[model samples]
Target: MSENPYSYVESELPRLLGNSSVSGVYKNKPEDFEVIEVLGFSPEVVEKGQQHWLRIRKVGVNTAAIEKQLSRALKIHPRDIGYSGMKDRMAVTEQWFSVQLPALQSMDWPAWFAEHMHAEVFPGGQVTLLEAVRSHRKLRRGVHKANHFRLRLKAVENADDLTQRVQQLVAGGAVANYFGPQRFGKHGDNVGQAMRMIQGEFQVRDRKLRSILLSSVRSFLFNQYLAQRIQSNLPYVNEGDVLILEGSQSYFTVSADDKDIVERVQSGDVHVSGPMFGEAPSPAKGRPAELEQHVLDQFPALYEGLCAARMGHERRPLWLRISDLALTWPEETVAELSFTLPAGAFATSVLAELGQFTEGEHANSTE
Candidate 1:
């Protein structure tokens, strides 16, 4: 068997944007990378509620650090704090967090936190409270609608044709959806650690840590499957493709005789998806199945380990659509970019196609 073409790190992965010539520096400072979380629905404040949902903007801090600070300040258990997703540690991010306070206790914690933020007392970085609401339920994972990114790439080199590259991406409408390097941990070590855990060499007692490892393994395989499709020059809409409905998780398999599959894909009514491997058999058949199996065959141990762990079956779209993409150059060597992506998509994946980037000093830390 041939060695896998896709690397665990995202930058080494095949780019659908063609040649990778542009080189730049990423996240030079916290201000250079900004993300604004957009929650779909507004939570109403209730008179008798324990959950305090707060929207906060933090510079140079990860989501968990804020949760820990809140727990310490409120004298509550760490589990009492909840968040939708983990925001990057080295960036300026605005996100929501919910703290479950005692229903009978009325301490005005939000006001207290806002004051502390203004006082700049927190150790990690500066945090400012944007909005706060009282609710009865805790915030859950994957609840955010989307994230808007504002990025500034410094010391950009060989970017004379950057505009044309962005145009090509805009004309193509989508980029190959690969998990960001952050997902695989520093230097893409999570997948290797997951394999050790699978082989009984590493024992993980923490449930959260165990889940992260499993997820990394699954993500690695998914990237491999997507890479194979791209390398083969396969069209997004193809026979036996498992199509995911637009704006939904629901999916259905298309038969070879399905005449309208192309139209549905082009109309943005559906998307071609790749297997999220687990114990359950893949619904893909024909060429799609062949492609998935080819990837699975390359890593039988990883495949069997996932099955033994009984990971849930899921599907992620093979293509990611970039929305409201805009770019501007502040100087000859500096580029500013802004775009919005649906929840669970990575801005780094989009950036990988635009240029090869070296992480700035602070960006080396884990989120």
Candidate 2:
């Protein structure tokens, strides 16, 4: 690991298929990037339940602020409001929020929004109610299956080459699933804060902020491990590797003699995983375990702090597969791209592999 574990360039993440030469400007305006949540369950499942779920389209607002507003408007504690995941503040995003209304309390949502849907409610941002339904359960974080993105890239060059790169990515069946810049916070201050906190040089009393900082530390270690694998030209899965099944959180360790694991990896049934350091014993063995240990060895303080904090062990995939990728040229200088990624994956990770963008701020703008 380097002196700054979290300072590596996003483009340095090994491209699974190869690199692309395309260049463009991303998110030139709020309307340029759009995200729609894909709730895996049907609305009818919760129609007769006590929870009221509202699907909202918000522009230039983050999830926390919207949750706060909902709490005040409903005259309930903040904990009474639930959301699946946080959406980006700068993009146009549609997501679901669940409110735990009393069993006997039922109000017309349209009339409710009519009176409370003003600047006073969402002070710095704007939100519109798209749909309202009843659900039996609150929308917990990470409940959504995936997020579909529609983005417009401006001043693009070599449009034909970009198309070829997308094809290669699809055929190769993987893209390096490095935690995007967003995980590290603006200017990557979270990583620095985590290092300080681990060293006892800084203290974060807020549980939420502390959790986020610790996550940044874990993400740094994961990226470092993945970067080394990419640098070594290692295959996605190795003997004795722990592999995560596609579309599931469950994982299993591969035996040294298991030759079919590679086939399973190539067929998109499983993926090679990197560690999210915590208290649990490492599930990996042999070279994979050795590789992970090497990375953690560079950040002893972070490793010790994580152990002391008693965080649970977890694994994240090293590669992400883009689904329903489509490209269209809205103008000679503009390109539109749409794709769907698993809930925890970042859309910017896909863009990083495509090429360098002129407007670099868009790198971490995804929800």
Candidate 3:
């Protein structure tokens, strides 16, 4: 393979690599998880009850499509429907949405939903009459808590045992935080477009339109970098370790060993994450390695994202974890798993692991 072009600026990259110290360690209108809550938030498993938050599954339809359907069905603004994250449409996806039909509480949801739409309702799903403020409250974004899930894929040659491998990282705090290539577009065409626009290469017959598109392109590229970090299992700087931050020129690779700052970085309490998207990839033999360099070259920012799976690393933030997985099958595949997670994690992340992941077909969705 070739060196991933996605990397930090040439002059900015570190000269050599060594073992990093073992460290502890959304979008739309969605707010971020609270600094304290994220580090310590972990909800206990619970049985279904009244007023419980629930997720509804709508297979086949994409997020955009579902949003349109939802808006039309309730005769409400598409904005009125709230979801914490966007589910993919081509594959089956489960999304959390609220509905308030006072008189319909006693009605059968399976029949009612079937009559109104084409998707099937799965178990572990919740349905409750919507509270008045729910309509006005923009569905909170960032997972209130996400349940991390594991899927074991077979068909691996001795060379590649991807299954169980991804799961092993969970114990070591290696999150699948990588921004998939989708964020970069094909060969990073979107990033390239933004580069041209940023360099003033675009014709301005319609300045406003051009600016908006260019901005979106930049954001996508950034998201790509973020995703790469998540996938790599980068370590957060903490306690005895050293770290660098590639901010503006004034603070390039600024290093410090302060425990407080390092811990803050590890917890992601003070600093969230930044994009390594602007950089190019590396010349490497494997997709995973090339991607790692793409992020590592970014350093500190991607640094946290680059930490690999190791023994003894504590999964911080008490992030999402699924235990007691029971796939119920009498009439349908009803997956019952206990979830304990931080306040801002995405439950869909767990669904993504279950396979057949799909986002609803909602055009207004801010995925």
Sorted on TM-score, highest at the top, how do the candidates line up?
A: 1, 2, 3
**Segments of candidate 1 deviating more than 4 angstroms:** 1-7, 114-121
**Cα displacement (Å) at residue 184, model 2:** 0.9
List candidate 3 stretches off by more than 4 Å: 1-54, 99-111, 119-138, 150-154, 159-176, 182-188, 192-257, 260-272, 275-367
Off by over 4 Å in 2: 1-3, 44-48, 358-367
Query: Across residues 1-367, which tens digit of lDDT does each residue of candidate 3 receive?
Result: 2254433221122111212221110111111111111212222322232122324544334455555666686577755555565443323344455443333234345564566554343222222222122122244555444433222212222212222332443443333222333333334354455445445577446654454444344344344444553445654432222222322111111134343675544444433334322333222223433543464454433222222211111111212233333222122222222333333333334433333223222211222
Per-candidate count of clashing residue pairs (backbone under 3 Å): 0, 0, 51
Candidate 3 lDDT score at position 12:
21
Q: Quick one: RMSD of model 2? A: 2.3
Judging by TM-score, tell me the better candidate of 2 and 3.
Answer: 2
Pick the winner on lDDT between candidates 2 and 3.
Answer: 2
lDDT (Cα, 0-100) at 310 in candidate 1:
84
What is the TM-score of each predicted model, taking all chains together? 0.94, 0.93, 0.44
lDDT tens readout by residue for model 2, 312-349: 88999888878898888879988888999989898888
